[model samples]
Target: MIPPLLSRTILATTLSVIFALPAAAHFQEIIPSADVLPEGGDVTLDLVFTHPFEGGPTMAMKRPVEVGILANGTKTNLTDKLVEQSDKGAVTWRVSYNLPEPGAAIFYVTPQPYWEPAENKYIVHYAKVIVDSFASGEGWDEMVGLPVEIQPLTRPTGLWTGNLFSGVVTKAGKPVPFAEIEVEYVNDSGIKAPNDAYITQVLKADVNGTFNYVMPASGWWGFAALVEGDKPMKSPDGKEVPVEEGALIWIHTSPMGK
Candidate 1:
């Protein structure tokens, strides 16, 4: 048994460490069942707002403002097809799309502004992911023209685990110099982070708004380039609050194996 004063001191120290730990970054996930459809069949997409590395405490998401697919220079609205899902009391969404043609399908989502009380602001993440159908090499680099977007310098799909993924952070079709990007892998393999710093990797783009990262593991990785919204929005409390605008892109990698 420990003395009362010493025990109290230890408790205070433990609490301080816990409070100082960095919070896991939130990623707007638009993960498809398969990034490459060999025969151009149906692919289901799971849209969840959560900390991908931690893989828990999924945040509630309202019905998205827009959901669409851009393929072959054509954009089709899929917002009406979203099916609501719930995970541990948090609202999520899913949709299935058929890709009959041989081309790259760019799926994007504009989520409803989420009010985060802890940050005293609203978050609107414009997220997108590319799915190549029938191994079509064409149209892999088409821009969706989102307000905030990532233009891939390297092809977004058909990547090996060690391949370096590079892109430019753009806002309204213009490069955003020195943008900050947060990266997290979908921790499907139950990989534990040694500490808070390993949970999310953060990096800044170059003067040309370009950034790159090598995927060390085989899984879906999300890159979110964060910036402030052009204007503040009304919060749930009726207060004007700044918005954290994130241009997010997800890519998948596979190991070289039999």
Candidate 2:
């Protein structure tokens, strides 16, 4: 009869084999159904296998591997990572990350090889994700709405030490070069955070309707970029040149707002 300790060791080895089979199979992909993700929301990236080891004779009897989410540049490992099992031979892994700014996020899945490195090896594949602006809203009309382009030129966020407000102005459709710009203050209601409050700054587009200007104040500010030509070449009652659609306006309020 086999000793009890020997039997227990065999059982443990069997379980490990079952779980390590999938990793040995080949390369896979985990995550991001759509390229563009809604900003500031829970992001769930699904894990899927691919070439090097999709479903085929190469695949082993047991399938298990590691998956993870890479936000901005940080690596969040999620392999062999355990989750409550609802049924048999099933597993799930999930994580959440907050993206405050608009930009791209990347994810990768690394398949681990169970066998020796010389004979078989594991690899990883990457996927790109884009986080859209939070300011977008139902009220925002593509044909005509407030401009969302707001960027710093020289002095990025702080007390006003000098005179110079410089930044590029881009509308939804095309870049607004030398656009007629204006600055003002709007009450902040959306973002409760003082730093995110709406402050106003007006900028005039350059010869191409792109705007680059400066503000004298250090408080929060906002801006409105209108496409009306310089000097309104036509009389008010005369044929009115239509204002281009996708005109943009940006609003910001600093902590100093009263």
On lDDT, the candidate that comes out on top is 1
Instruction: Name the runs in model 2 displaced over 4 angstroms.
Output: 1-156, 159-163, 172-174, 187-203, 228-258
- Model 1: per-residue Cα lDDT at residue 18: 83
Q: How does each model score on lDDT?
A: 0.95, 0.36
Worst 10 residues of 2 by lDDT: 137-146
Q: Residue-wise lDDT of candidate 1 within 1-258, one digit each (tens)? A: 999999999999999998897876888999999999988999999999999998877999999999999999999999999999997899999999999999999999999998888889889999999999998877988999999999999998999999999999999999999999999999999998898889899999999999999999999999999999999999877989999999999999999983
**Model 1 Cα displacement at 48 (Å)?**
0.2
Each candidate: RMSD = 2.9, 26.2
Where is model 1 more than 4 Å wrong at Cα? 1-19
Residue 209, model 2: lDDT of: 47
The lDDT, on a scale of 0 to 1, for candidate 1 is: 0.95
